[model samples]
Target: MSYPAVPRRSAVANAIYGLFNPIPFGFFVAALIFDIIYAKTGTILWAKSAAWLITLGLIFAIIPRLVNLTQVWITSRRFSTGADHVDFWLNVVAIVAAILNAFVHSRDAYAIMPAGVWLSVLTVALIAIGHIIIAVRYSTDREYFHG
Candidate 1:
């Protein structure tokens, strides 16, 4: 089966795409690092807040765009490689989990709910993986393949 040609992005657009592309991943990595550091230093409050920040960041800023882009990426990959369903579902679940975590963190229950923090952290990790996959797949120079 033939795949449609990928559109050529302008330099500015490419840079913006590259910058926006890794936001989810970066949030995840930061959350994880903060969690580990806080845990080692016995700063549970900071750890929890960092995890909440990551979750809120994803829910408010990243997840919606991520969902849209992921859908496009999945469709393109399926069309181009004839690949079966992959981790797309996992990403969706992570988005949902992050949303839930954000909701919980916004409430008074967050102070006592370690599970919520962990779930938020896990969601970030999953989203980061999803971001990495999409970035690698789409951000490459199309000229290499087209030429």
Candidate 2:
């Protein structure tokens, strides 16, 4: 099972993807840090800050994810291996977890303690795994989409 050779993205699309793809990772990492700080200090400010960061991460993730969705599923007829699907689903699940974490953070500050931290951890882990998958696939596959 190999992906069909689709036309490469326009330079503008590549530029947009290159610019935005890693932004969410940074935001998510920051959110995780804030989550940890909130957990340790029991500060409402930290919890609120983390919620904002996660929201920002999701916002930043949109463009790259849309590009990925089109390239991996809509354009390609098949994946060379299962890793592509794993990477996509990992990202999707991470986004879902972050959304849930954001909702959890919307509650009263103290109420968000352990659950917020756990969700943040889970989201970060999933995103990290997704990125790792991409890195590994890119190293192995000559036709990897991201160039």
Please give the RMSD to the true structure for each candidate, in Å: 5.5, 4.1
Clashing residue pairs found in predicted model 1: none
Alpha-carbon shift of residue 114 in model 1 (angstroms):
4.1
Q: Provide TM-scores for the models.
A: 0.53, 0.84
Candidate 1, RMSD to the unseen true structure: 5.5
- Against the reference, the lDDT scores of all candidates come to 0.57, 0.83
- In TM-score terms, which candidate is top? 2
TM-score of 2: 0.84
Candidate 1 lDDT over residue span 1-147, tens digit each: 575665433455446545664566566556656655654565567566665666646745554455445444643444432111334555667767766655655544225256555765778767766656655665454545654
